[model samples]
Target chain A: MRRELTISDQRIDEQALGKGRAMSAGMGAAVYFVGVVRATEEGRPIAALEYEAFQPMAEHQFHLLFDQAETRWPLESVRLVHRLGRVAAGETALWMEVVAPHREEAFAACQFIVSEMKRVVPIWKKAFPLA
Target chain B: MPVSVLVLFCSDQAVSGCYKSAVQVRVHFYSYFKDLAGLAEVTESVAPGSRLEDFLQKLFLRFPKLAAMKKSALVAVGIDYQAGDYVLAEGDEVSLFPPVQGG
Candidate 1:
């Protein structure tokens, strides 16, 4: 898989991230996971969320997680992009796409990537609850 | 006889024949810490041979509101995750991160 990890303060380009993967004819499945800023947290109404990151190290962790994902499954392509700074409720904060030859492997790898990213990445999100 | 001369530089006043100096460590704040601290970055001076824990202790002292997060927060020196006891160096970039909620 042509693995890529990107972190930016600007809006995430969904189309660009989901497109242009050189998938082999044999590879048929593609799975994507987009994490958005929810309107509430712990039952409290939220207005927005502000994201911050130790940029360099966060990128490093993303790359490391991709390596782990590749080792665990047979993947065709992968892309993980996360946005930093203020993200209003319902806006996309994270985008992940995993491509594999089969649906099972694609789903599993996609889930693994998101979980590992949350566990290890240095990025953080702060909620702004509504009054 | 050949002898090596050692140089000592102190920023604090010498007392009772003892010399003391403080090393300045620059810290960068993020997320809620930034909101609480009301600033993005600040520098704190600690005694020589101070560890990351000591710096954090001093930080919490200055910003008591941040104390609650000490247990879950992560520390990074430069671009790598560092243990609490990691010795801090002068001009080293120290970052305090709240428990990451990113996906």
Candidate 2:
């Protein structure tokens, strides 16, 4: 089986997106979330946001999150992709999809996963203001 | 014994009649911490049996600014958040950062 959780320095590609959302007949709901980098940080203009991570730890934490969500909800498929290095403003920084048997499970699990990620994930962002 | 006592005697023997082993831990700083720490990663000597929670306090000697964020700092031993009481050992990779947003 392929890895459903990943952290990459390259941009999130079409190939990755294609594989994550594949659903079986048993699944009924899918929640897709995209988090973009804004053009400003602290109300000032910025060129881009530079992202960095302890990749090995980041991947491990995501898997833990996936496991936690699975036990709480009837999940069918889950995919989470986080971008590293410099991501331009208005570009994607993170993308996630949670699929379950019902919309309620999908939404709850997605929110739980993202909330835990923000609290525990070892990722950081730096704003390189326009210079 | 708490590592705090050993830390005060770090310049002493490793395991003499009244001493204990000291360890070197690899610590990685992130986000604002990297800037405050003035370096990405460094190997710091830790008193034998120091817990992960004591890391920020121990590290403050070198990077005082980082300790200022202790109330808001985030620490982890790999993927899991290690509490202050989680005893750390040599060869451990620790990440110390401000509240984070990755993974």
Candidate 3:
């Protein structure tokens, strides 16, 4: 079966992330990344942060990264979620989960996926730090 | 023809200002740069054949905060980062991204 990629702005669900992991169980290993909004920015208190994206381009890039991962590694499934709109401090910003038949390939592909996402994804973050 | 450039900043915050013109190129800013400018996009006209670095220097003059991040920031032309001296061309899409923190 072909695994589809997930993209959303709502809060990330742990159960959903777990489901992605579970889907890879018999396959071998899973790699996951959870990006959280920190409480501080440049030593200032961050009250909230808003994430904006060039939606169509960002989604296209997300799928492209997943395709790259699948080709580069022996991954059975991959799921990536990035939130849009306002997010409070200490909240999740993005999550990437990749499952492969081997730990090395899973770890490496996960790292590559996150780095590439940050580099190419047309997503921007604005922080509203406490005064 | 004058280059058409678009500068984008945070619309809600007074981070900086916005400039829109009938230029051929587009410039994008993200993170603190957008926050300070209070816009998400700005457009300007640049003389043809201007170097990307020169355009950035002009931007720094307009927005001093941009100067601070110059060393670490990355500039992309049509989705890929270009060299310092990359020449501005008609209809080129440029983007400025701050240091990314993702885990």
Candidate 4:
């Protein structure tokens, strides 16, 4: 089992994620989400945003999240990535992929992962208002 | 000699504050507070029976920006967030997290 979770600002490698999905091809289906940086926040223009994380704890929590999903579902793979530092508009902010024995489980796990990540992770972001 | 509480900031500065001889607590900061305080952690001395809220009040007085964020900030002891009146013990790690809005 992989223990280190990828927490970064670099763009996600969809091909790699697809490969991971393919490894579990016969098992079921894969669900994925890519969060992109938007140009606006609350209807106001945003220039760029800064993301910071308490790395050690955040990584630990992420591993726990993955473990929980695996325990709750017949999942073959789970991949999650989040960006840190300053990100410009239209850039990717985060991505998550999960492969489960069925579409329903995959979909549910994907949603749960993203929502819980936002609610529990020690990562925070600050948006800069556009001038 | 009385046990002195040491508050260490990310800036590499350490401050000695009044603390009870029996308890040593570490406080950490995030987001704007980390930036403003120029430190990731602060150590403070507490009375033997100090409440978490009272310790926080002392912190707020020392760091005005931290005080300002109190309303919206979330405080956690180690991995769990505790209530204002939770009793602190020696070597407890307290974290101050600003509102999080990450995907």
| Winner by TM-score | 2
Cα lDDT tens digits for candidate 2, A29-95 = 9898888888999999999999988777778888888888888998988888899999999888888
Which is superior by DockQ, 1 or 2? 2
What candidate 1 gets wrong by more than 4 Å, as runs, is A25-28, A128-131, B1-22
Report the TM-score of chain B alone for all candidates: 0.78, 0.74, 0.71, 0.76
lDDT by candidate, in order shown = 0.83, 0.81, 0.73, 0.79
Q: Candidate 1: TM-score?
A: 0.78
Per-prediction tally of clashes: 0, 1, 27, 6
For the predicted complex of model 2, DockQ is: 0.56
User: lDDT order of candidates, best first?
Assistant: 1, 2, 4, 3
lDDT of 4 at A16: 76
Q: lDDT score, residue A33, model 1?
A: 93
Error of 2 at A86 (Å): 0.7
- Say which candidate scores most in DockQ: 2
lDDT of 1 by residue, B1-103 (tens): 9998664545565644434566788888877788877788998877778888888888998988888888888788887788888887777889887877786
DockQ of each: 0.54, 0.56, 0.17, 0.49
Ranking, TM-score, top scorer first = 2, 1, 4, 3
Query: Please, what are the lDDT tens digits per residue for candidate 1 over residues A64-99?
Result: 788888999999889878888888889899988898
Q: Give the fraction of true interface contacts kept by model 1.
A: 0.69
Instruction: Estimate the lDDT of model 3.
Output: 0.73
For model 1, the local distance difference test gives 0.83
Off by over 4 Å in 2: A1-3, A14-20, B1-20
